[model samples]
Target chain A: MGSGLLVETYVFVLAVFVGFQLISKVPSVLHTPLMSATNAIHGIVLVAALTLAASVRTPGGIWVAAGAVFLATLNVVGGFVVTDRILGMFRSTKRSE
Target chain B: MNTVIQLLYLLTAVFFMLGVMRLRSPATARSGNQLAALGMAIALAATLWANHRFAGGALIALAALLGLVVGSAAALKVRMTAMPQMVALFNGMGGGAAALVAAGDWVARGPGGAAGAIAALFTVLVGSVSFSGSLIAFLKLQEWIQGRPIVYPGQKAVSLLLLLVDLAAGVALAAGNLGQGPTPMGLYSLLALLLGIQVVLPIGGADMPVVISLLNAMTGLAAAASGFLLQNQVLIIAGALVGASGTILTQQMSRAMNRPLSNILFGAFGQLRTEGGQAVEGTVQSATVEDVATLLAYARRVIIVPGYGLAVARAQQEVRQLMDKLLQRNVDVRFAIHPVAGRMPGHMNVLLAEADVPYDRLYEMEVINPEFAQTDVALVIGANDVTNPAARTQPSSPLYGMPILNVDQAAHIVVLKRSMNPGFAGVDNPLYLNPKTQMLFGDAKASLTQLLKALDEV
Candidate 1:
């Protein structure tokens, strides 16, 4: 559980490598969904958004933080749902028309 | 309890990685998306529990609920034709959220230290830029704004000046303390958003895939910067992962068009031909629907080239019907899918799939290219730029060196188009005028229906 700037950098770099290995193999047909899925993953920014909302004391800060939470959640929820819908359309040769 | 929260975060990151790995195959992609959603649920729960003591709990819940409802409803309702801008809008929102979070940190905690200040500034800058840039991309794709590149006087110079000022503000805020000026962060954030608009304004609608991908990467990096400011491992990991994904897609989309990312953003592609098609030296032979139907009905093999115009006219169903008819006539038929055929990467595949076109018959540019030479007739529907022979033959043309479909190699070429107007890139197609080419000009849907009727009579 120990943390520091260096540890955070390590996590970032390693996660990037993992992302490359995982996403590069996605064929062109699945690109939109993949982009969308990754977009949903980053909607984890809602973490920071929620924390910021909790920390704010003034009205202006609360409003800004609320906007943050809303947008992040929209990104998270919309991104995943749409990706699923798009993937629903993709049928291989085995599937009937 | 702190240790437990950190472990939950770790678990969420693991789920994310596993989910992305599963996305490599279409069969597993749906579950993969659901898995990532599960991870998001875990993260949300953990965040709620960790911040249990904080005020504004009701506000947070309300905002999140509204987001959930709105996002899901919009996602459920948006047509497949509008997917690119929908994704672009969501990307913008994420970026906006990141910027707001960073701004919140700066306003509340006053930067905390030099490193924190820098991270917060970066988050604010990149995130805001991504937000505005993506919104403009949305407007362009949606055609709320003109699809052509909108260049103004001193565009680059103004953007450079804005950057210099933003840099000055960022330095002052980082080197000194927050509240040092009458809104240093505000100035920096505003300038960043404007810079995004300035950068994206010159790029035409045809380059939307690259712009959207680039903005996606920017949003991810902005989230990571917020992670540094807040010291959150989950933010760092997930943000980095998406940053990498977006970067890979951006590069691949650029490669498909044979252009560098720099050229895409900076090249004023449609500016010169905004009035209409730049007349090339060739006599275009206009054909009746009967002539095309006769050509197609007699052909032994036919390859279809579709583009954004096909999507615009909602002719995917008509195209599928045409394919079936041609197959019944013992004509071998396949679709040539350019990587950038529609508004986004793999856009045509999704459209075709939605129309229930069998997957085996849809071929990518590289695989289907050589077949064009032997094809008896190439049926081009609402596609222009991709099938342009000038892209191969004219060096002075702006679209020179861009990889294009070799429809010119086919024994006979028949195009269904609305007018002689240029495509999204605003470049005239010489393919319309080639000696063997026959153009059937009308709205794509109406033209396809007429052609189908004529197929029986011819």
Candidate 2:
């Protein structure tokens, strides 16, 4: 049986609260990095998208699932890699150290 | 086995949380990103393993390989200057994926019940909107479309009508009365996409960063809806965190601009404020590169104010070199960064960071505003709106009440620009006409290089 809708709603609401608390402390200078980083984290949705790929039976279903998988993978891999590239630039130079 | 899988998903959620938390500072941001990536890997592996009984393994493997190649190539090739557009594109892809997943599930399994139907409807609606809207934002940033807000008469009314239609169709679908085919869901999805385009089209380019953040949040919420349809806990948690954090980031960006969220989303900003043209009373004074070089070389204290122009000119390296040369001459030089200096949040900081400028020399608006008065020379580089005196002096001006860097307070101000034209807000800047300010008109890079050459000779 499903975990019931109420439990999922509870998780969603609590996670929202946690997100708010954690992100509020980020300073303005780190805002871009924060944005890019969060962009990467949300790529976890790929897990949901990929699960649909295996069970799809029809030709149309397979095509759609393939497209979804492609997009989700791009979101995850590109999101994380690009975010890392940007954050790597945040490393201090000799002057700051 | 189910218990172990749940525990692993829970651990992945924890790692995602820790990743976001670690991103609070620049020092730990890289590790934070790595942690999040690791969590994504664990979640993906667990999902594939638990759902192994499903068919089409070969197709899934092929898709994974294709996605990896394309994603890694795009990530590695994108320049830091185009990071905003890259983020918009990647975020949009995630939204598209969520929408597709929901559509796939509905087609294959049918909405199981009222709750399932509602979740599917929401995923389709929000995901389609986020996807289309982010694509528009990416195009705007990429200059494929005009960065200015595009609006026609009755645009707002039409957009509202589309939203209402989408909502009605959603309700119809959720009630299971929209027939067996995907007709109703398809119509609503199309409406949501159009609505997203209409809503974002009227926001000027200058406000794109905030709009991007808002859309990112929408995508996250859409993904959470997909999680609900699939009854997946980790997807829900990850989606919620991204959604909530993106919302806060949007609010913070809007606050930094000193504009209300509603105004940014709906405001057709950046239109020419010709009515406010009377704000500036004096003619601009022009100076040459040698004149600026002489002034800079002799100054005891110099504060550099960088704006979007610096990014456009790709002059951070030259600027850094000048700073180093001046420092070598025993001159006290610092950088004054405005909160909303460039197109994206912290745009200037990242550019300067890339140029290997010392992080210590960069002071935020509040920290450096007061110090401008004591400085001998305040150098303004390709920055217009952030340094505009109209923001402080003219209530009739569009930029009124927006806190600006006090570059005017310095004993002498040298502004580097190609022309006397207004900035992104398309409003007049009286600072250009100020008696204390000298306009050094040229390409920012060429002007800086000339000024640096002269300074070296001096």
Q: What is candidate 1's CA lDDT for residue A77?
A: 96
lDDT per residue for candidate 1 within B313-392, as digits (tens), equals 99889998899889889999999988888888778877888888876788888999999999999989888888887788
lDDT of 2 by residue, B1-458 (tens): 87888888998999998998888777887898899889888898888887775466677778878989999899999877787788899889889889989988887888878888888888988898888999999988888999888889998889889988889988877677786565666677788889888988888878887888898898899888998999999989989998998898788778778899988987888865556545557889999888888889899999999988898898999999999889888889999998777777778888888887866678889899999989999999989988988788877777888889999999999999989788999988888888999999999999999988899788
Q: What DockQ number belongs to candidate 1? A: 0.79
Show the colliding residue pairs in model 1.
none
**Candidate 1 stretches greater than 4 Å from native:** A1-3, B177-182, B274-280
Alpha-carbon runs more than 4 Å astray in model 2: A1-3, A93-97
How well is each residue in A1-97 modelled by candidate 1, as lDDT tens digits? Answer: 2358879888889888988888899888788888888888879999999989878877778888889999999999999999989888878767764
Assess candidate 1 and give its lDDT: 0.87
